[model samples]
Target: MSGMGSKMLELDDEDELKDFRACFVDDRSGVNYLDGNSLGRLSRAARDSIMTAIDQEWGVELIRGWEHWGELSFAIGDTLAAELLGAASGQVVVADSTSVNLYKVIMAAHSLVPDRRVLLADLNDFPTDRYILEGIAKANRMELRFIATAMDEPVVADDFAPYLDDDVAVVVLSQVNYRSGALNDLAQIAYTVHSVGAMLVGDLSHSVGAVPIALDDDDIDFAVGCTYKYLNGGPGSPAFLYARRRLQAELTQPIWGWFSARDQFTMAPGYEPVAGIGRFLVGTPPVLQLRALEGALTVVCEAGIERLRAKSLRQTELAIELFEQVLAPHGFRLASPRLGPERGGHVSFEHPHAQELTSILLRDHRVLVDYRAPNRVRFAPSPLYTSFAQVYEGIMALAKAVES
Candidate 1:
């Protein structure tokens, strides 16, 4: 074998998470998948757990399953908090979509600082986040201000310096840029926002499972993320929301449902929202999806986020290295940060024909990648399942496709 191939083998062998590949279902269709940052591969544990829930819990237990299912969201949330997110128990819950959760948390945080009339967010933020904030600001007669930054650049405290003020009640940010994969300094940004007496609401969908987050240590007031991507909970899986324990008491999410009611089983007439994280929940929890997510979380917890982060850095480093050696010469410009610490688990390359190239790679080259907007192709090297060999092969395939 060539030196590069040998190196790939050596790296794969040295990987502590290599054994985790077998824990997930193998993709035997001869396709190289590099889009886990968009949607992670299905894990065997999640599949088996979902099946068991269908057969035993829903099939046999039926209505009685509510006994345990009622608290599953909290249990899973605590697991996510302790394992992936650096947060405490009773501060996170698995329920609703990221958009819904963001809406709830943003609205709740806004209420806390009703005197402030402006809400701030990055202009290039994910569509759902921007939209949610926009709607909230418009309906509540508040101004929605945006911090303009390059798509490939990380949003820093300095970037928000012009926008930070006491009038800025809430500042929304993504832990990692979805398009360029640029990781933000959450702690520093949080301090800046808080100094201005503004709350920080982070959208962690793109970084949750792939990156390390310290919600409590960072002093993030509110955050939301989806499980379908790096969490590998399957499509449309339940997302999670986090509210600082100190803020939970005063925060009241706009959504008021039986599930959020205090003594919810009482089905009482009045809407007295629960005291803790459960108050953010709107309606019935998606039991089957939560079970699948619970199963997926077990793998993440067992592998350890610190270990996962180390592997992620190595994988993204290799990806950028390979891209520079091969694809860069083929009119592919690096869109994401060249430094690993400033980036997430993915690397993005910008090409004029990114959309066409993406389709060609998927259909002809049998390499799975995803494209964004006018000209960006993203490769997510999931640390748990993706091997170094696959990363090499995926980039090489892209080179060949571009050259053709």
Candidate 2:
């Protein structure tokens, strides 16, 4: 092995989260998987939990399973709120997809300040988020504005200042940039948005389990995130929504399904929404997916988010170091923040041929990663399942792939 490879192995040996890697089912496909920011590895606990739910809960208990499963959404939400989001109970609920949750929260926030006619978001916001804003703006006859920012830079409070007028009702921003892996200052942006009486809606999809977030401390009004990425939840798992305790009473989501009905079981005569976070829920929760996430979260809660964040920072730092030393010579330029604290769980690089290179790395080099847009390749080192050695090998493989 090379000297650098030996150093990485040593770091892995001392890693505190080393034991947690065994909790996941490694396919042993010999691929250096660095796409955890896109989708996390499956955990053994999640598999067992799903099987148990299918055999015992569903087969044996059958329809009676509702007795225990009735409140599973809220129960799981509370766990996520406490462990992952740094939020209080009764403020968060697990339901719907990230896009759907964003719609609900953004619409609810807009209603709070109906007189305002403009909705604002980052110019490079995720495609789905931009689509949702466009739809909402057209339907409500409101103007939607974007805070323009370079692809490599994050949208900071300063960027939003010029657009924050009395007409701006809701300001939406992602806690972490999906493409650049840049971390935004949530507290500062929240303070800035609140200053103008505009509500701040945070999209936590890229930061949730991989980074430490204090929604309450930041005074963020509403937030949403997916569990399938850093949380190790299975594919198509429900996303979570957070509405501050103060906002729950006044806000109402567009969807008014039976699950959100005040008396869900009563088949109520009217469309009265339930009180608290339960009102955000639109339909019956996906029991099996929720179970998978619940089971997977046990590992995260046990390891703790602070610890996870520390390891994530170190791993990403290592990746950046390797990139500077090797990949830069091969035409890769750092697209993410150079400072670890300003970055999320991953590091991204820009190359003219990033898309084609990504395909070669996956098909030929067995280095799994994802490519974005015009030119970005993201390498996500999940602290729980990804080791320092994997991060080292993944970048090294990318360097070799470029050479060949």
Candidate 3:
């Protein structure tokens, strides 16, 4: 475990998710990908499905495909919501980028609680969440509170307790922290936010496909996530937004387009929002991309999230063990929390030369991982396709890169 030469042969031998590894294209060639946190490997089902969608649907159906295309977002959302989101149908819809969905839901949520005027975010929250909060606050002249921000490093689930206050309109929390691979307690935070008369908005961009969640059971007011990460829905496969069924009536949809109207067939003049979650659709559904996502989602459903969670824990644990054995001697400090509840499917390590070292590892050793600002390399081990051998080898390369 401590040496750096070759461990993949044994590591891959022990991987339970090894059989499912063939499900993806692994376009890496000779490269070892440890960056599922950034972008997931292309699934075979997704690739084949997109091929058919592009050639057959766009080619043959032409302009007459609206009948089915119109409902693609909802259909995909229903499966994802029912199977993965721990919620019933009619609560989620696939549309726009995670940023856009955040904007939509935040806007709607603010309108619902007009009297409150503060938005709360943690120090380790993703950059996009921070940026979206800043923008939303600036546009509305509301205040953005970076709660538990200063003198803070690696804050855990209980760290949010001090920041729960009555003046906050909504608390935007990432279900999983981006750089450190830390996980948040969604239900507990949701309850906390509600206790102070504030709604909770969660970003599941890193949680949905890797772990399981129960929105309705948790009484979560709003949620949003991207498909291309853990969902393996190809690159930039749009995103999905969720609204509690009862709360849908309390907030007006901010996104406007013909596809989100009550009746698009008549081409009416009046602008009326479509009922329920459909009202959040900004434009025409990306039919081909949606099809590709649906295909990838089918694979996730087939594999199942519970099994995915268990396998992800094993792979990440393998990586962490390898790091402790190999990198601890060298100088790469473990930055991510070791406990299970405080982690997602990825791991993080800190080294002063992260930027240069990451580039070197990629160029000279064919290793792929992401570098956060300052000094951190994030390695995301996707449960469905990535193998333990890959993680073991990637860590060895990291150890060698930093030492030699």
Candidate 4:
């Protein structure tokens, strides 16, 4: 180990959350994994649970497992709601992908106020979100308005005040910016949207699990997020959506699969949607993937989201400190918020050759950080398994890559 590695180990020795690292499978011993914001590292619990789901649930119980499997989506969703999202039990359901969930909620929002002819969204939201909003706007013949925000600045409630009006039916925003890790104030944005009689559709894909979210308390009209990222649910794990209980009766999603039918087994001719959050379900749940997510969520619940959030803030602060001390002198600039509370779990830096440097770090040095478009390298030190020592080593590797 190098001098920086020794110092990092000293910091890790003092970290109270160091025990949590044992829960994950650390196969790449020499590689520092820093892309948890894009895809979380799989935990050992998730591995064992998936095996049980395959061997015991499928191999032995067979089709009979559907009896309990049928409710896994809602059950797991309720767990996520209570543990991660500050939401009510009957308000959230796990189903579909983030794009599909967004489509359902956006359509529901449009149906509520059919006369409104404009849809509002952030100009720099994730590409999939922007694509969904574009399709919705084109399909409904409604005008789409985007709020231009600074790359490094968080989007606050005041940012929407100038653009919001009676004509805007829905305001779509991401709780955290994917590239910069800037955290938006959900409560204030929800209030601002409601004040203009517009529904707020939040994309919590990057915020949930990494940061604390209060969907119900904030009065968020609709929200969608994926389980594959910070949730550590494996690749392509099912996504979840939240629809406030009060809005369930009035909202109607476009998809009308058997799962969402009032009496699913009836094989009914007409499509009668179920009451509450179940109405958002489109088709049969993915049992294997759901099981994987349940296992991962079990770990998250055990650790406590609040504790995870505290540690995440601390890790990010340390990463920023290291960047300022080492990488900043090498022409790298901070692209995320300087304040811990104002940012999410990741720390990003803008360099002229960020993409090339990211490749060099991965290929030559075994450091793993992801690069965003243009010139940004993002490092996410997951609180669950990532150690402060790893963050220090990753930055040192980045410094070497810059020099090379």
Q: Give the TM-score of candidate 1.
A: 0.98
Alpha carbon lDDT of residue 339, candidate 1?
81
Report the C-alpha lDDT of model 3 over 1-404, residue by residue, as the tens digit. Answer: 54433456665677666787788875757888889878878889998998898888878998887768888999999998999998889999998899999999998888888989899888567888999999989988998888654211344446666766778898888888787777777888787778788988989998888888988988889999999998888788989999999988678877778878888678899988778888889887888889889888877888888888988887788778888888888888887778765678888888899888899889989999999988998888888878777778788889889876
Candidate 2 local lDDT, 135-206, one digit each (tens): 999999999998789767766788889889888999889999999988998999999999999999999999
lDDT of all predictions, in order shown? Answer: 0.91, 0.90, 0.83, 0.91
**Model 1 weakest lDDT span, ten residues long:** 147-156
Q: lDDT (0-100) at residue 255 of candidate 3? A: 70
TM-score for predicted model 2 compared with the true structure: 0.98
Question: How much RMSD separates candidate 2 from the native structure?
Answer: 1.1
lDDT of 1 by residue, 21-56 (tens): 998997888788899988888999999999999999
User: Model 1: runs farther than 4 Å from truth?
Assistant: none
* TM-scores of the candidates in the order shown: 0.98, 0.98, 0.94, 0.98
Model 3: lowest-lDDT 10 consecutive positions: 148-157
| Candidate 3 TM-score over all chains jointly | 0.94
Model 3 residue runs over 4 Å out of place are 1-11, 26-28, 149-158
Q: In candidate 2, what residue range of length 10 has the lowest lDDT sum? A: 147-156
